[model samples]
Target: MDDLVINNLSNKGIRTGKQYLEGLRDDRNVWIHGRKVQDVTNENGLKSCAHTLANFIDRQHEPKYINHLTYLDDDGDRCALAFKTPKSKEDIKDRGKSYYEWAKWSNGYFGRTPDYKNASLMSFASASTFLEKGIKGQGGKVMAQNMVNYYNYVRKNDKVLTHTLVNPTYNHQQGYKGKFSEKVALQVIKETDAGIIVNGARLLATLGPLADEIEVFPSTVLKATPDNIPFAFAFALPIATKGLRLICRDSYDLGKSHFDAPLSSRYEEMDAVIIFDNVLVPWERIFMYGEPELCNPAFSATNAVVHMMHQVACLKLAKSEFMVGLMTSIVKASGRDKDLYTKGLIAEVMQMTESIRALLFSAEEQAHEDQFGNYIPLRYPLETSRNLYPRMYPRMVEILQLLGASSLMATPSEADFANEISEDVEKYFQLSNLDSKNRVAMFRLAHDVAISGFGSRQALYERYFFGPPALMASSYYDLYNKDELMERIDSLLSE
Candidate 1:
């Protein structure tokens, strides 16, 4: 372990926080609203979020956080904890701690943090056989090598990768059976000795503008037919790749002071629709191509979903914990902690927090070893976290709104406390315990969490982050085992 730590400290491939920031100054084509972003590193709407991620990277070199954020690899090179492929119970625990630590930086609001894709790459590396099995050709060995190389490249460099999995929903009413439009979804337009030329678009590439690379994969189920083959491919490319364009939604950062828009000001992870105009995906970058059958079960078959959700479970736990803190502080400051109704509401929030923590621990405790010898968190519990949290998150937001109540509306902006009406504002808004400024700040944070554009986006993002709740529940039902309960009932009837 010490060697691993030492190796990471000395590895050139491992980028410092400053290096990470500087790397984003590339000529990537990123358009927000109508304007093309020249440099994401310095863009006002993107720089703060990029800086937030850079801080996480910087922490790896800080003595206080280095151990918690990173580990030395088998080769004795230091790597981010998120890139570690768990081979034991301890490894999972260590990785979980790192995931929790990173999630805390954004209070679990930034969903596309580097750790998210790092876990995916770790999963892909562990289950390289899946990649080999999915591809058909004389180039099977070459494809396998590519997967290994890509995984190593990402882990070594600690690359920040954003993914676009779902196709645009433009013609969803026509459904999958109708003639598939080539222009609407990313598809292989031409194949060459150099690589494949991919064209069309994909939606919801969270953090696309700020990432080092963009990974494209299948998110929705696909038919195992020739018509869908062109769209079943998966690959990763540098964000600077020519002809690749990211058309972003409006910036939510709003340039508000941190005291005013606490979450959004620092954690606005921009989401965009990616358009590939004959983008070249090198042969070495392609993971799966011309295979819809493999694309559909890519997550389950590779156990990537479980690993990815392990990171998300840690994130949800952090979010719930943050909510618990917010609710407690709100109730205490408002002098409502003693109220039975208030206590009940706060307890409900606590229960949700503990529920997420319980699932996280249970999944780690009952960890299973995959065919590749990686110790993965138990699928059922992790999946349960993924399924239940979407439902729980909105309620958690509502509880904040309820606890804050009218106080949420009464708070003044940060400017009010700093300007001409400072004395008058402070006199009127000061709470019994918290200073007026602090009280206002707390409410401002609450408002950002509950009422602002940032707050609303967080709710909607969590709701459909893993797709529709009902579909996920039904899928879980179909995947889960019922044989034991049925057998017990049969035995009872026979007796």
Candidate 2:
């Protein structure tokens, strides 16, 4: 492939699904376990997932879905709805609708879909001044231009971005004493006329291997010392850039049939640690650099947290709805729908579903314009949903286990249904309404959702994806308005 053409393609209008898939065949440094993965598009554990994401890209071109998934830019070229910064209540609702469409495609299982980072990019672009505050010298104007340019590049090209914002874990004792390796967290190694050279690693890049670009930003508070200044930079770079490596975790997609490992088979958005070994981030890609004071507040200051959480709220609602559907199906298939305990468990799941749905509606209905004149979902409701869902998700999984019970354990693989003992298995496993094969398939899905490794990862992802619940709760408390209530109490006491 011609490097110049490849680099310049971002100026072209939106890529089709096929184009998106083809783009992933570029030279990217990716490793899974001990083996180097040559191409994620053809890797055994990653291809299906790559295709699933491609299908989402394709949805933008399909007439039936185009209206819901995309909108025309000011330049009159069609762009993804996810990239449209909401300026009105209707725009906020439309973005929510687009998020819903993508979330449903994965049944809310794929957490790092393109729309996730789209929210982030949109937020950063809308608040480009925040980037300016962090930049020094004559680079401030250049950095601000880079922000606009990158945002336009992504939105126009309909790029898929995965961000790595967490520092890799090293010995805390050593890190606190400034004795840790410079590579423990992503840091600028040197700056040149061309751009900045970065060498280090970042953790938990959810879709690192499959993404078109990788965003390295600050997610945690940083000390404003000179030692911490190197680690406070933020930038975006193409995944195909030389020396950028992705060390992936174990893939849950075990090449099992969809009938057996339903969720994992189609929706494993692989997480990996991103290592930048002297990776060159061109001048146009650097958003912020060397300002620790501004790094920590980048997300909050730009309102990116709220925008990203709004997308997450939509995804969580879909997940809750999926859990409800799965639980209802399990109860009916097992002929326990009439049982009081079963009804109660199902109701609990239903309540969770309705609660998330209500929060989603509230967030949109009460949406307010931010300082940038972009309409953002109600922060309080979205933050509350973020805090509550982490707690609710674990219980939802437990409910699935309870409702599934022995049926979940007794299920056989899809192959078993075609084997020599198929007759005996069918005779014994058949439910009253659902046939043996169908019943087993349903349980297999339940197992994938509640009992499998994929299920466990989902539980953990929900628990910590947005940081600690206690911190979020405290943040809500800190940010909430309490003056009116306190004043009313004082008035009553005085009277």
Candidate 3:
């Protein structure tokens, strides 16, 4: 966008849901189902998610939720709670509580809550000085200030952001090693007085169509060689930026009623492949430019990932608890709550849920001051939660399927209850305790969570939320403080 737009951001503490939707009527090119969507707020498969997020935005203005989701800044400006510079342990706990509150809005179904990116931006901005250090002392002071400016700008306007990191992989082997091909990877192809011109495609920008802007950051560790410099920059642009096109996966909503596809109806946040076709990223928007040494450690050095994990930890807790609730409802409706096998399956979910809850609490209780002077939840516990929840979520889904059994498949559509065969459906579909309508409704929700396309995608999303399970495990192993544990083993042997 031009300087006029950047410099004229709205100072409104929080925007209404209608205002948020209206702002999305920009020039963003979003395609789905072999057609370019003209308006996400009105599109059949995309509208529900658009308005769901709008409600999330509007919740910031709600009296009951406002205190949890927002806070007054030093200048007395009411900024999003995610943007608050967390300075103490209490701040960490408060943030965690707020994250849980937001997650409950969708029973943890809406994975890409705006607060997720907001947390990342807040962490980076709070530690803006690290960006000032540039790789090998390259000119980074300006970029540091740019980040500070962008953070304040977004917080003031309450802008919704989606971010892209990974580039499309034509070859699995090369891609796994963080290799980028010029034919497909987004990179700087030319430089102008105004900014750098980027072209090529990136994989997996979630919430791309509905977001106000997109943050295109480094995808992975860069080699820092002259050859790799072009691909090492970080920047943000309005989603409506000219030449930026988003090709989204087929939407899962498909206009299903809330009763028929409860989760899908409310939480099909779009994922897309972003193609930056000679897109110009202004100098003011560049957070990192040709600095692999700095870019590689950007998230870690600034403790941004730790704070990000804190947010994810709470989300996982919400999700896990939601699964437990779903399972309980399933068993109770079938009068199988007293069955030992049924109890065994659900108990496992409860155990897993409690483990996640404990890990989140441990991280918060162990909060410490980082070098950036901001308080961050402890990494190991949060890291463990991040690494473990992916594995846990799928197993929980499996347990749900096991417990749900025939009832999951025996579900009747909401339409069936009003049809001529309504009498047959009412008599046959009734569970031990639940009548036809409520039973069908419960199982439909269960189907949406376990058997439907929406449910399957959720499993896939969690499995790779932090990239490949092997990579996450390897990173976890490397980051573990194994030296102390090894010493303990050594002392035992010596003894």
Candidate 2 clash pair list: none
Off by over 4 Å in 3: 3-5, 492-495
The estimated TM-scores of all candidates read 0.94, 0.94, 0.97
Put down candidate 2 lDDT per residue, 328-372, tens digits, no spaces: 887787688899999998899889888888988999999888998
Q: Which 10 consecutive positions of candidate 1 have the poorest summed lDDT?
A: 1-10
Q: Which ten residues in a row have the lowest lDDT in candidate 3?
A: 1-10
lDDT (10s digit) by residue, model 3, range 1-495: 552155455664677889889989876899999999888789988889999999888888889988888998766778789888899999999999999998988888888898899999998888988998874566788888889889888888888888888888878776666567889989899999998999999879888998998999886556767777888988999998989999999888878889989999999988899999999888889999987777877878888788888888888888988888888987888789999988998999999999999999899999999988889999999989988988899999999888878888988788888899999999998877888899889889999999898889899999986667887788899998899999999999999
Instruction: Indicate which candidate wins on lDDT.
Output: 3
Model 1 ranges off by over 4 Å: 1-11, 173-180, 489-495
Distance from true location, Cα of 176 in model 2, Å: 9.4
Question: How many backbone clashes does every candidate have?
Answer: 3, 0, 0
**lDDT of model number 2:** 0.84
Go through the candidates in order and give the C-alpha RMSD of each one to the true structure: 4.0, 2.3, 1.4
lDDT of 1: 0.83
